[model samples]
Target: MADVAESERRILVAVDEGEESMHALSWCLKNVVSQNSKDTLILLYAKPPRAVYTALDGTGRREDPSGYLFSSDILAAMEKYGAEVAVCVIEKAKKMCKDLQQDVKVEVRVENGDPRDVICQMAEQLGADVLVMGSHGYGLIKRAFLGSVSNHCAQNVKCPVLIVKKPKTNAFNK
Candidate 1:
């Protein structure tokens, strides 16, 4: 939350461990730089699929990792960069704007569930005015293989959705 006063404008952003997320967050800061309204920025992470969760133990048994639940991996990753990454968004905002404490609120929400469903539900629950997300910059093949969560979020969420796709990298040159 910045010092901008868009009382009706709340942003919910989804991150998938990519720099694109940082870009989106930066965009939000730019938009709400002087905002003085009460606003929230939710940093949400959908739970990985059963297969991804199972790969840890290599047991082939598919178990739900529990959406919105904090796990060791999540905490460990947050611990990196001296826990600065976890606090980066709000900390940066606080540093930039002296009114954050008096006017705006920022929260980090880590949820576990189908990303598509979780994003929409969380936005609805929070009464979000806009949903922000990284595009993952997938090509036809990668989108086809993994399914596009941003695309799904755009289609399903009632509010306007901003899908921020990073410039294509060599990772998807099929």
Candidate 2:
């Protein structure tokens, strides 16, 4: 019975908006697929709250309180990229599973708040058996800054954690 159950385990993958995450998600879908065990792919995106602001207009006129968040272009860009990225992850995971002949459920989620905190909370709430993710890969110049997601999960998560540390590609590649 233990052996029977072992083969039917489910995997929960947390994907960030980066190449490494895409790579990790791709790898899992291709190699870990199984007819017995179901894989659950969860894509995580940042949804930080908008910043409020007050401004004055011309002719000594005061404008009503409002917020731009950051900038019109940035907000638009973020919205576009966030939607595109999440869809890409879902499509990639689905394509991989289809090709691999596995039965898996992929869940793509976009949420607000700190990435680290949100990921940890999501992992627990979903009762993920294992968390598959990539180590901090993009930006932050490994020598200077590090992403908090990997570190926080390693320290706080009770389930097993898989960290993909593929070598750095180009200076900007993750």
Candidate 3:
């Protein structure tokens, strides 16, 4: 068991290229994480596996005639796009922290896998005190069909999970 005094408080926030996730990050920064050296904020992004596409040759053959089996360019482009999204999210999180005047340590991690699996695994591996994420606020049928990453992470992770749901209000409500 790790000593209480020596263990730093690790708060892991799962982020993506979505407004909901960004809202969760902002909420975590404002509420959960403290501005102290003993607290660390980890922003995690999971890139889903790319789909494999096949190109036909001039003779209508399924495989390429140039001896190249697959399109490396397509794969590279997908990876590049994922990297850019990850960088953008991380930078935004950093800026949010700066705006909040939080001096806590911030770390960014990007991995290729399912978001549900990646978030839970990272929370456990980092010994996080709490895992924060955004709720898409899907309805029963939609959530049943599409499934929920936050629900899966909440169920699977060892630490407590915080799901930030976006507030629904009309202009007149405020």
Top candidate (lDDT): 3
Query: What is the C-alpha RMSD, rounded to one decimal, of candidate 1?
Result: 8.4
Question: lDDT scores for all predictions?
Answer: 0.66, 0.64, 0.82
Deviation in angstroms for 59 in model 1? 11
Model 2 over residues 68-161: C-alpha lDDT tens digits? 2355676677678767765776666566556664557656677767777777887887787777787655565762565557877878888888
lDDT of 1 at 133: 82
lDDT by residue (41-68, candidate 3, tens digit) is: 8888888766545564244454646533
TM-score of candidate 3 to 2 decimals: 0.82
**TM per prediction:** 0.62, 0.65, 0.82
RMSD after Cα superposition, model 3: 4.8
Candidate 3, which segments miss by more than 4 Å at Cα?
A: 1-7, 54-70, 171-174
By TM-score, is 1 or 2 better? 2
Whichever of 2 and 3 has more lDDT, that candidate is 3
